[model samples]
Target: MPVELTIHQPSEIFLNDAAVKVKAESPAGCFTLLPRHIDMATALVPGILSYETPEGREVFVALIGGILVKQGNSVTVATQMAVEGPLGDLKNAVDVMIREEDDRDRKTRAAVARLEADFVRRFMEFRKNA
Candidate 1:
């Protein structure tokens, strides 16, 4: 069975006439919903959400914040925010986001490492004094 999907956001709206299923990001992790997916909802986060149908994956809303999937043969995504652009534009945006995320993660790890080192040094000094 094929599923119908409609994607809407503040700036754009996209619809998929023949959708198989959708894979989107959630607070917990990546969630995939097919025609048999039980009705459920999840918190939205910055991530990639992709939709696929019998004709193949729909490229319109490949990147979205989050999605709400309904049970049955038809699936409707209710949301308030999304980033929409052409195929090329979307591709570029995704690349940029990936790069930025990698950079952010690296910085966060480095900061934690530095903080841990400082704490360890302080503890060593206090132990020596005692």
Candidate 2:
């Protein structure tokens, strides 16, 4: 029997299909899930997630980060972001995504710092006025 695979993102369902095999990367390393695999759950890192369909065609998904659960003949993945495409394209996409995420983080930090500084300045002015 084929394993029912479902991938979910915060905004929408990324994929729902039947897979003969599923491969993903976790903190420990990469692993493949096959039929009759032991039930388990793991935290997935930002990497490529691939699965072989029953017809033996491979599909790839670029994942930012996620949680995966396998039970019986069902596997579910919940990720913050996911993009499905060819293996080569997905690899490059993941690299770009990482860089974009880092840039966003830096900008967010700077904005927070500016907000804190403004708040402190306002508080000091209020004390002086009082």
Candidate 3:
């Protein structure tokens, strides 16, 4: 019996496939799951998720931190982000995604800081006038 693997992201389903084996990284370390594996759940870290198809071909997906659950022959992964493709391509894609997220976060922080500074300045002016 093979295991059914499904990966979910907030916006879409990342992957749904039947896999002979699956490998993922967690806080404790990396682990592999096979059919009949014990039922458990773990906090997944940002890493590569690899699985073997029934035809014996291996596929890889880059995953951001998330939660993973294995129950019976079903494995479910809920992640914030994932990129799936050839291993080399997937690595590049993941790097780009990480950089983009970092840039967005930096911009958001800068905007918030500016807003805070403006609020403080306005408050000081009001206090002086009063």
Candidate 4:
């Protein structure tokens, strides 16, 4: 029997498939899960998730961070974001994702600063008028 693998994101399900084996990384270390493995849960770090289909095809998914739960031949991964591709390509994809995330953080900080400056300027104007 194959394990039902489901990868979930905030907006949609990233992947739903059947796999003979699945591997993931956590803060403690890397581990592999088989269909008859004992039930467990792990907190996944930013890393690659790989699995082997019943037909022997291997696939990989790069995830930021998430929670993985295994119960009765079923594996579920809930992550903020994921990118699926070949291992080499996934490495580049992860690098790009990190850069994009950093850029978004910088932009958010700049926007907050502008809003704060505007609020202070308005407050000073109100004081002068009063």
Could you estimate the TM-score for every candidate? 0.55, 0.86, 0.80, 0.79
Q: What is the lDDT of residue 130 in candidate 3?
A: 100
lDDT of each: 0.68, 0.94, 0.91, 0.94
For candidate 2, write residues 27-102 as lDDT tens digits: 9999999978999999999899999999999999999879999999999999988889988889898998788878
RMSD to native, candidate 3? 2.3
Residue ranges of candidate 1 with Cα displaced over 4 Å: 58-67, 84-130
Model 1, range 4-97, lDDT digits (tens) per residue? Answer: 7777665666554667867777788777788877777666556556777697856544343455757677666665544554556666666666
Ranked by TM-score, top first = 2, 3, 4, 1
RMSD of each: 7.3, 1.8, 2.3, 2.6
Judged by TM-score, which candidate is best?
2
**Steric clashes per prediction:** 1, 0, 0, 0
> Better model by lDDT, 3 or 4?
4
Weakest ten-residue segment in model 1 by summed lDDT: 57-66
For candidate 1, the per-residue lDDT at 66 reads: 52
Q: What is the lDDT of candidate 1?
A: 0.68
Displacement of residue 25 (Cα, Å) in model 4 is 0.4
Tens-place lDDT per residue, model 4, 1-130, is 9999999999999999999999999999999999999999999988899999999999999998799999998999999889999999999877777777788889999999999999999999999999
Regions of candidate 4 where Cα sits further than 4 Å from its true position: 103-130
